[model samples]
Target: MDIFELDSAFVLHTYARRKIAFERGENATLFDQNGDDYIDFASGIGVNSVGHGNGRLAAAIADQASKIIHSSNLYTIAIQARLAERVVRLSGLDARVFFANSGAEANEGAIKLARKYGQNSGRFEIITLRNSFHGRTIATLKATGQEKFHARFGPFPDGFVYAADTEDVLRKIGGRTAAAMVELVQGEGGVLPLDEEAVRNLAAELKKRDILLIADEVQTGVFRSGEFTASIGYSIEPDIFTLAKGLGGGVPIGAVVTTKKELFEYGDHASTFGGNFLSARAAYTVLEILEEIKNSGKLARTIGYFARKNGEISAKYPRLFLGEAGVGLMRALIAKDDLIQQAVLERAHKERVLVLRSGGSRVRMLPPLTISKEEIDLGFQRLDSACRAADF
Candidate 1:
């Protein structure tokens, strides 16, 4: 009879969730059915870049739905082509794109691209960063660097190896190495940023050895890091990059963008729902808003400034805020203990501030890029109060 009771009956509990149900959201705030407002920091796990019910996004989606929602990939979609052009133009990486339904699907396409490129080369292995998070699919789960995800999912798609640095990476790659996949920020790995030096060396080495370097930009793309993609912050150019999360501006879409030379000739890969007209319109809307945000520089600077501000917060309360790490809008505050994490999350929820847990002991914050400085201040104040009142 109750909403939570209905959810409990139908939903399998794969995630350790907070006990709250949001009825609707606007900008960076969510309201429960009872009319309590919560300052949103998770932003649906970084999917809502332009924030809830963005006028432009809603209009674009509505316009496209009125005209056409989807057509088979066999017929060229004009909007999809336009979105692809914009993606290539902004990336400046001279890449083509293939759309997919979600982040995991984009990654699946990337893995397939690597395997296809490895054909007849006696190399079929992909090297991933240790503690890296890719996706939840079988191929991606196998390719994921974290061993925990492999639990009960195996006998997975073979030929995935995890290594930490250039040395270990080199050791892992042999005659069977096809691609070296990495994330600039390990979003699920406690927001750990990859070593830039290691990435540079690894990219160069992988390039020299003719191995494709795939950057998983799912959680770190579309100005979340004060730029187009977090990969830009590292200055490491990947051969193939998978993008999702923020790309659609809160719509369901994914893209695998890659170099002109890296794409398949014909029959290489495809997705039926990939570049449909509606999602393409959504992507275009997102990019347009991002351009405005970039031009303003206020939101960009504020997104970048939070790291330093949180760094100060970390110093002020070292016992509670162990530290802060991440780039741009995608950030995580290191909690001193798991109990603090749970307590802060619970209290924040009760106080109407939404947060998330990552890698066991971090409070993940993914406020929309459109979030205002005032909103950030308010949210952080609530979070601070929640932390202080939490039974740690």
Candidate 2:
């Protein structure tokens, strides 16, 4: 049997698998088994920060693996320690770090930390924004705001609430509220970004009530949002921040960082493969590349160029395009409806550019940060072709 038949036979049908099966990738592009090239605007759903097959990242992983890979967290690992220090230093927050395997696990860790911090105070509730996407784990699923993901997955743990307005969030923060979790850019929610002023004001209010603010930077961190963290650009100093997706380039790694070390005590939480040497080396290399990009000012220039091109696309096709919103590489093009959005994505795929959908009517674009001007232009041309070919 071929790859598709093999997948259909054995794999669980959780995702609506795309037609093309990618065999290999190079910076900003993926190649299928047939050797057809597709410009990767999705960037593995915002995980490949430095792009595919980065030599430095590969060398780091190989070098670390040749020496040692998994030295359980029980002992002090040198690379892990160095990564923790780098994260704390670059975060501009006095915090401790706990590593995990994915975004869901990081959010799960953050939830546990919040619940423990508020256990004595009788505050166990977590308030998340309406339409926000957290994760797939039981705890993180409960923390998510959308009901579609909750189908048949119950009985969900209590103390989770959804709020749309700031006043509503404030009202929900009564005695039972432990923390308020937010995504600076709600990537899955149509790539929506919260207003800077609103986030700052909300953080201040949560501070007064002693409610921990958890920023889910799973999709928006690591220079995907122009800054190291979107919270930094928004000026919202969250008490706890969860990171994953792009932290280890293509490697699986997640982290929960907190300003308060007292929130987590011994035996409260741990992960076996969290900060293993291999993943730590990948993450460390990614951070180094990010620092170089920032220092060279290429990140800022690329972000500006992308935003301008998105604006041009929206302006050129006002009848079908609603608008665009988001920060840095985490952007979306709003279609007139879900049908139009689907049509555009399908056409774009045929045009050899890989994009993704956000919410119902948003075409999400999360291209690699290291993408070049020529690649960006090519992606834009393909997207334009898609827009023209789409029926609606």
The regions of model 1 sitting more than 4 angstroms off are 260-262
lDDT of 1 by residue, 320-341 (tens): 7778888888888888888877
Residue 116, model 1: lDDT of 84
Give model 2 RMSD, 1 decimal: 1.0
RMSD (Å) of each candidate, 1 decimal: 1.6, 1.0
Model 1: per-residue Cα lDDT at residue 350: 69
**TM-score versus the correct structure, for each prediction:** 0.96, 0.98
5-69 in candidate 2: lDDT tens per residue?
Answer: 99999999999998688888888988999999989999999999999988899999999989999
Clashing pairs in 1: none
Worst 10 residues of 2 by lDDT: 165-174
